[model samples]
Target: MITKSDSTTIKSYLEDSSNLHGGHADKVLIPENTAELSSILIECTSKKMPVTISGGGTTTTGSRIPFGGIVVSTEKLNRIISIDKRALSCVVEAGATVDDLQSACGKEGLFYTSHPTEKNAFLGGTIATNASGARSYRYGPTRKAVKRLKMVLATGEIFELRRGEKLFTGRGVSFGLPGGRRIEVALPSYDMPNVKNAAGYFVKDDMDLIDLFIGQEGTLSVITEAELGLELKPPEIRSCFAFFKDEENSWAFAEDLKGKKEWKILSVEYFSENALKLLRRKNPNVPPASRGAIFFEEEGEEGQRYSAADRWLKFIKTRGGSVDDTWVAMNEKDAENFTSFRYAIPEAVNEIVKASGFRKFSTDIAVPGGNFLEMMRFYKDLFRDDGIRNVVFGHIGENHVHANALPVQGAELRRAESICLEFVKKGVSLGGTVSAEHGIGKIKHMYLKEMYGDKGISEMVMVKKALDPGAILGLDNIFPKELLQ
Candidate 1:
């Protein structure tokens, strides 16, 4: 199915997205359908060529490019199979973009709540990373919405995993086989935390068969299609922006909001001074005095609106939090303007990095709620002492913050990396995870153990070996050889 001509153009096109740390791949393979995909993969496996799969090229962890051999991209596999409205689920090809799915669901008055920042991110990559966003504090991550998956195993076997069902082991696409053979192979399970977990493979005893593939990052299998659950869009929404003089007052306000029972706060975010500069560049109309911002959404009766706003006003007033500006959106246009501020940070970072001729590095860490203030204080002091100018912000509601190191090159870059290592060590010491939403990939593989103990990492390696004996898929990417050494 993969002709010589197919390899030429596919390889050329695939190289376009390999803007990663090390470099791009020399060769690439693109299969239009599952059969062709299987054929290409089998050939690559037999030839012992290392392979990596890519989606939107938004992987901050550098998982898109192959270190040596070939890269396989699922970009062409974009198609929505079916939407089972009655079941509140939709089956779609892995390459379908988040925007595509959200648009389709919008037509039926339904909403797909998983809102990763990159709208162009393919479903496959999101599943691989188990991606989450601001709403993760309320609706959870991508794993919660996925019900079934059709994945291509490393051995080139395509399997369909259903919720509350077993994985078929025997041949012929049947749950059971002739000759008295049981058809299912039970995978070892681990109890996944109910909170957002986008790090690695989610496993637990008595866990659903689908959980194993949720965040495996293409090491275990390449997902082709998935069935995702949907929810109804909120009826009436309002956006409120609260600005604080400093991090302490803003954090205190966040804590108070967390205890409120009536309001459904969708996203509570914080921005450092550097982040504010970027936001201003993206939206010059935004008031310059705004140091920090918080976006809140309220649903249900109009009676609750006044009360919610009044409570927030009182809290901020008491905590010395000032309101530089605020916008309440009764319609879609106003809502878009409000969200633009929140979404512009990533784009701004990209622009700044390109303009400054420096590479971008970010650290995402989550500390316990009780230790969050202390953690922020420590990071602020660290950055100030080191004279590192960076942007820091994320889902403050969940105690997860993404501190992005400003673009730096040459010897300064090495110094920045060393500072990052120290930050990682401090984060681990404070009972925080090193990489929160981003997967380990290659850049952060060394810090995986620092977040999770040696025993935990060893178990991860064991699972990887059990699923992919040849280590062909994303080989030496997530859990590299150096770590084992």
Candidate 2:
């Protein structure tokens, strides 16, 4: 493990995708294996040093940012231990990136559930936040796909856990940590949202203990390895981009497609007019008459693929979109291009945020499926009269659309912050989640408290205290800085 205080390396390691926030670190360590990881943790614990466990730095939240202590990176621990094609599962070291795992699955004609092929995102980080992408509408998030996980706690307690290996006793599951100490985290009293969520802590009645670790954001333990369940690749996957002259109609069309049982719809993504403009800036040849776009993919057998495409064509035309305007991708290269086009919207927005020299204040809130239209109407009505240059796009199938407010001036940036918080308040009021994919990392800690209130926060704190008695893991993460001390 490298422990030198190289400013250049420490600076690079302390920043994540949430370029808006960063922290100070005196040192950095890249552990190559769990033994090394445990030893490092033990040393840090003895000295009472705050240790930040950084998997991949692609975190949109500031969870990876170290406040005062050394940062422990999982970069060197990347190794695909084994792939059981027959069982459709793969065991990987915590440092293995999402791209690496997906490529390995592709070689074997298998698939991992999470489609977030961001090269920098590690398998451990994905599990840390229970991250989900567009395909989550059909395949759920990382938590649902996880089979088993291994972790090294703050006191150097090394343990491996599986989903069904333990049960609750009306108190909570307990574990014998590495340092010969027992850690018992009782189940929290609060229930998670019924919709998609990645908030502070995951708790439920008779919940599997694995659920707590899957989305614990390193506040519970530092993930060292994981067993991910895979599935057989589909015979044929067809993609389509349907553009609409009016943005509202695209939302309606998306809602209608949700009821189509004939086709195996994998995802339904939405792109707004301003989002389209951002895409054009990044790629000139987007499409003609494309004020708003609906990107959907259907996976099925060869015969069903074409039939799904035909149905989508007819539906788009009926919804005021021309058949010629729709882009269909049957080949692999075309499919890649279609996916890239969908990803371009966010890249373009990030560019806008960077050029403006302001920290991005993107909203990642979600409402219950039934309250989607209500929340959309709220956003449309509020932003329609306002002068904020915002673009809304994301996993529309789950009623989680990200509103990226591009505020150029300083005052506008502050206004964007308030606007995002207000949106979170409204979403939580509708029985939704303050965070959909991104967890309540350092930046969204306040929103987590706002959504859950004092009693809820206390319940989470109880769990935190149980797992990390020293409060040595992930300072300034989901819990408040004050809670750590």
Which is the leading candidate under lDDT?
2
lDDT of 2 by residue, 310-357 (tens): 777888887888777788886878888999889877777777777887
The residue pairs that clash in candidate 1, if any, are: 189-204, 190-203, 190-204, 191-204
Give lDDT: candidate 2, residue 317: 84
Candidate 1 stretches with Cα past 4 Å from truth are 1-19, 167-195, 301-311, 481-485
Backbone atom clashes (below 3 Å) for every candidate: 4, 1
Minimal lDDT window, size 10, model 1: 170-179
Best by TM-score: 2
Error of 2 at 305 (Å): 4.8
Worst 10 residues of 2 by lDDT: 170-179
What C-alpha lDDT do the candidate models reach, one value each? Answer: 0.70, 0.83
